[model samples]
Target: MTDDTMGRFGLSRRTLLRGGLGGAAALALGAPAVRAAPREVKISMQRSSVLFTVLKVKGTLAERLAPLGFTPTWHLFTSVIEPMNAGAVDIHADVADAVPIFTQSAKAPLTFYARERGAPSAEAIIVPADSPIRTVADLRGRTVGVSRGSGSHYVLAAALKRSGLTLADIKPAYLQAPEGAVAFDQGALDAWSIWDPFLAFAEAKRPVRVIADGNGLTSYHRYYVVNDGFVAAHPEVVATVYRALVEAGAWMKANPEEAVALLAPIWGDLPPAVVAAANSRRSYAVEPVERSQLGEQQAIADVFYEAKLIPRRIDATDVKIFQPPTGRG
Candidate 1:
C-alpha cells in the first residue's frame, strides 16, 4: 500500500494504472468552473402604464434587483409585438392577453412570464359627446377606430356580441392609440376603442363619451412577455425582473398619489389628477401566468383566427409561462 514499497517492486502494471487513475481524477476535480454569460434585462416601456413609469423614475426596481445581480434597462415602444420581433426589446411590460396569440400565429419567438388581474374598465369604446351612438348596437354601419389584436379589440368584440352585433356589422379603422385618438378628435372616426391613459387623455381634453367599456366584456389580463432567446439564456434575470415588477406593482397600488406624481411628468405632462383617474381603473397587481389565464387567451386566439386576423390557430398554453424561482438554484 506504501509508495516506497510499490517503487521497490519496480512498478507493477496494476500499480501504474492505479497511480495514473488517481492523477487523472485529481486533475478533473481541480479544474476551474466556467461562469455563465452576463445578461442585461432590457425591458420595453410605455407611457400608458403606471407601474413602468414609476418603477423607472423611482429606481426602486434597480435597488431590488441589484441584490439579485441585475438592473433592467427600459426602451420606448408603440406596439407589443413589433419591437420584440425586430429585436429592439427583450421584454414588454404590459402586453394585452390577445397579442401573444397573434405573435404565436405569426411564429414569433415570444413567451409570457407574468400576468395582471383583470382590469376590464381600463379599456372602452368611446364616441364624441354629441354622437348618436348610444349603445354598442348603435355602432352598426359606422367606422370605429381600433388596433387589431389589442385588448381594445377584444373589448369591442365582446361588447358587440352582447349587443347582438359582430365585427362585420361595423367598419374597422385599424389604428394605434395616438393616431386613433387624433382621428376621434378630428371627427374622422365615429368611435374609438382604446385603453387608458389614452382614455383619460381623451376625456381630459376633449368632449367624448364612453358608450361601452370592457367592464363586462373582455378578459383584460395584461401580461409581461419575454423574447424566447432571452428567457432561455437568462431565466434568473427574467425572474428577477418579474419579482421587481411584482414589488413595484404593490408599491404603486398602496400609494396611488405617489405613483401619479412620479408618472405625471413622464406621461406627456399628464395632470396628476388625470393620471390618478387612469390608475384607479387598473388592478396594479402581478401574478404568475397559469392554465386558468390560458383559457381566455385561447378564446382570444380562436376569435382572431375565426376572423382571419391571424393566419393560423394557436394553442395559447403552448408558449412558456414563468413559474416563480422554486429554488432553481
Candidate 2:
C-alpha cells in the first residue's frame, strides 16, 4: 500500500492511542497529518592529517551516521583550527589545542565532546635518521620547524622544557605540514615538530628518530568537537557518530593492514609504505574527557601563555564538555 494510505488508515489501534489521537474514530474521521521526514545531518571533518586515521578507519563521520537514517554531509577542511574558527565545519577532529583558541576567540559555538582513549599519541618531535640531533637537548641552537600554534608547537615547547630548554633555545621556523616536511628533507630544518601522518611519512622516507611522543611529555588528547548549536539540537546524531568511531578504532586495532588499505586511496596519492607506517601508530578509541586530561591540556596553555603564543591566559577546562558513550544495541 502507498505510504499516504498506510498513514491514514493502516496505523495499528495501539499506535493511534500512543500517537495521542485516543481513538480509531478520530483516525478515521480526521485527516492524517503527514509528518516530515528527518533531515540529514552534515558533519564537518578535517581531511587527512593527524585525525585522518580516526576519520577513515573509524568510519568517516558521514558513513557512521548513514545507518541511523542520517545522511552525513562530509565537509573537508584544510586545517581544524581555521575551519572551526570560520564556522565552516560542523565538527573539528584533532588535538585539544584548538579548544583554548576557540574559547579565547569566541569565534564559534564549540564544545569538547570526547577524547581519544588511552593517552593517544597525536603528535611528535622528529629528526631525519641521518641527522646528528639525538635528543630534545640536541635541538638547541638548531632550526626546529613546526606549524605555529599547532599541537606541534605545544609538543616542541614541552619537549624543550624537559631538557632545560625553551622556544628561545631553538630557531623556530613556522611552516605548515607539507612545507615543513619538504624543508626537513632539504636540510633547511634541523628538526621537525609535527603531527601524523607527516611524522609517520618522515620516519618511513628517511632515518628519522622520534625524540618525544604524546606520553608524559605532551598533553596531546585528540578531540572530537562540534558547533554548540548543532550539538544541542542533535545530541543523538552526535552520540551515534561517536559510537561508530569507537567501533572503527577497535576494527583498526584488529585489522591494521585493512585499515591502511581503506585509508590509502583517500590520502591523495601518498605512498603506500608511508600510509602503512602511519597507520601503525594511530589510536582510535573514543574516551570521555576527564579532569586529568584537561589538567594536562591546561599545562600546554600555560606554556603558550608564558611564551606569548596567544594574547590571553586561557582556562582550558571550561570548554571541555564530555558526553557518555553511545551504547550499541
Q: Rate the local accuracy (lDDT) of all candidates.
A: 0.79, 0.69
**Model 1: per-residue Cα lDDT at residue 254:** 89
Clashing pairs in 2: 129-207, 129-208
Error of 2 at 153 (Å): 1.0
Instruction: List the candidate 1 regions with Cα displacement exceeding 4 Å.
Output: 1-39, 66-70, 326-329
Return the clash pairs for model 1, or none.
none
Q: Name the 10 consecutive residues with the lowest summed lDDT in model 2.
A: 47-56
> What RMSD, rounded to one decimal, does every model reach?
7.6, 6.4
What is the Cα root-mean-square deviation between model 1 and the actual structure? 7.6
Give per-residue lDDT, candidate 2, residue 143: 93
Q: Pick the candidate with the highest TM-score.
A: 1
At residue 211, give the lDDT of candidate 2: 80
lDDT of 1 at 309: 76
